[model samples]
Target: MDDDTILVTGATGGLGREVLARARRTGRPVRALTRRAALPDDPGVAWFTGDLTTGASLDAAFAGAGTVIHCASDTRHPKHDIPGFHHLLAAAERGGTRHIVNISIVGVDRIPYGYYRVKLEGERLLAASGTGWTNLRATQFPELLDKAFTVLSRLPVMLVPAGALCQPVDRGEVADRLVELALEAPAGRVPDLAGPVVQRLDRMAAGWLRAAGKRRPVLAVPLPGKLGAGLRAGALTSPARAVGRRTWEQYLAGKASR
Candidate 1:
């Protein structure tokens, strides 16, 4: 393990950046896969330029890398998630990759959201990748909640799914767990990671409004069909498996201070 280089995809994204930073502190050789041709001046960081969509130029990225932390996803083009991930799997196999750590969202199996469907397919692909792998399902992040509220705030009144429960974990905490998985022997599927507290969607929205200094009133509307029912039933949260330490209110306070 000491000689193997840890390669991370989606190096520019929020979670991936946290993974890269934590990996660097461990003093293990780290390589960040990106689309840009130019890399930074940091001697410790090795940058690989490649396109996962076509799998072209990935040879250089997979070369000499024994462990891979896959944090990249194609949300805009859901169709691309599986094909691109297949490209990664093929390259990893050819490169003699020992372990692959994948990040996934909780409730992908039950949620009917388009992007979640793609994530579910990804899980299938990894299970049969024929390589050592570990997949982790983490609850929603504070950033995602913040973004959702920001978009809904466009309306005069923010409409939330009534009785919907949420467990929002910090991105940095999830990153730490991914790195821990990458360091250990491959685990097929780990336990779910969740936030410290399970709160109602309306409560989270109120906290966000207070932090952002907005007075927009939040209205809870009963969501329809299975998706709404699952959320209202607390399908996204694991009260017994609250592995993360940071709470949503703490996250809001942290953002406000910054």
Candidate 2:
């Protein structure tokens, strides 16, 4: 219940784990919230069991934590995101949490995808919640693309969206910015963070195939609607704000080395 504790939601996930590790380096009391009833002990973090979807055990999670870095999202069931976010906002308000830094995807407003729509609504809710908040919109993460490619590579040929452009930022880089924002006063809707390069999806897929030692041919398939058009238009990229230092090639190289 330290007043200076920084609570991280989704602490076991990719980005959240990075944020939690970096936040611990600052020597402040760090709390990690997870849905799991039991977690392996981590001496630096005070673990809290909570569920945003049901608003279960949230009061104890938010109890005296001055800042919250919200990185939780259920991509499979995107419909639950809004309700979960609403629960978070309510808990923050009730607990008098001083600042909240929310992680969101880029092009959420322009993209027609259901998950992106939910993310956009979450941003709006945080802004109107009467609590101090900051929202960061980042482009696609390399891990997400890697998972997609793993699924698509199972077919005879990889089917990539025709002319689809993607900017795959490293999750760790995004985590760095989120933790930096969490320590500062809330700055609403800060500048977008993007990958170092914007490359065609097919090219990225080819790179993945090479790295993973898969010899599948890549075929660019035309997407027939607004969803396809949005990706082709590069709505998911922020060329001007391409401040992320790590490249997809670097991420793949590191993964291969590991």
Candidate 3:
């Protein structure tokens, strides 16, 4: 019930795990909220079973927490995005939570993607919620960019979106920024974080192949609709805010070594 207690949702996810690790380093009370009961035996972290979409066990998860790091999201099941966040906001308000830090993606407003639309609404709901809040939108992660190529590497040729550009940031560093926000005063929608470099998707995918000890030809395919045009025009990137340290090639090289 202390003001120092920090509750983190989606604690098992990529960025959420990093946040928990960093939060543990602070020596403050930390609560990790996840849908599963099975969690590692980390003495420094207290695990709470909960589901953001179903709003189950959130009362106990949010109880006595001053700050709630709302990282739980459903991009694949886009339908759950809005309702899940709504449930979080409601729980935070009722539980008397002080601050809520939300993780969002860049170009949600500009991009016509369905998941992005849901995320945008989540941001809106959080802003209007009766609790303190901070929303941080970041560029795509290096692993996400790697996935497209990983699957395409199976074929003789890698197909990429025509003229699309990506500034893939590192999730580790992003977790750093999120924890920083959680510690500081609630700032609504801070400056976005992007990758150190901006390059075409085809080039990034090709680098993945080289790092994986494979060879494949990259072909750029033109995509239709506003989604394609926005990507081609760099709508998904924050060029001026390219503050991330890791690059796609560096991530790939490190992966290859592992």
Residue ranges of candidate 2 with Cα displaced over 4 Å:
none
In order, candidate lDDTs are 0.89, 0.92, 0.89
Candidate 1 least-lDDT 10 residues = 35-44
What does the lDDT come to for candidate 2?
0.92
Instruction: Tell me each candidate's TM-score.
Output: 0.96, 0.98, 0.97
Off by over 4 Å in 3: none
Over the stretch 111-187, how does candidate 3's per-residue lDDT look in tens digits? Answer: 99989999899899989986889999999998777776788778788888989999999999999999999999999
Model 1, position 99: C-alpha lDDT score: 93
Candidate 2: worst-modelled 10 consecutive residues by lDDT: 1-10
lDDT-wise, the better of 2 and 3 is: 2
Q: Give the best candidate by lDDT.
A: 2
* Winner by TM-score between candidate 2 and candidate 1: 2
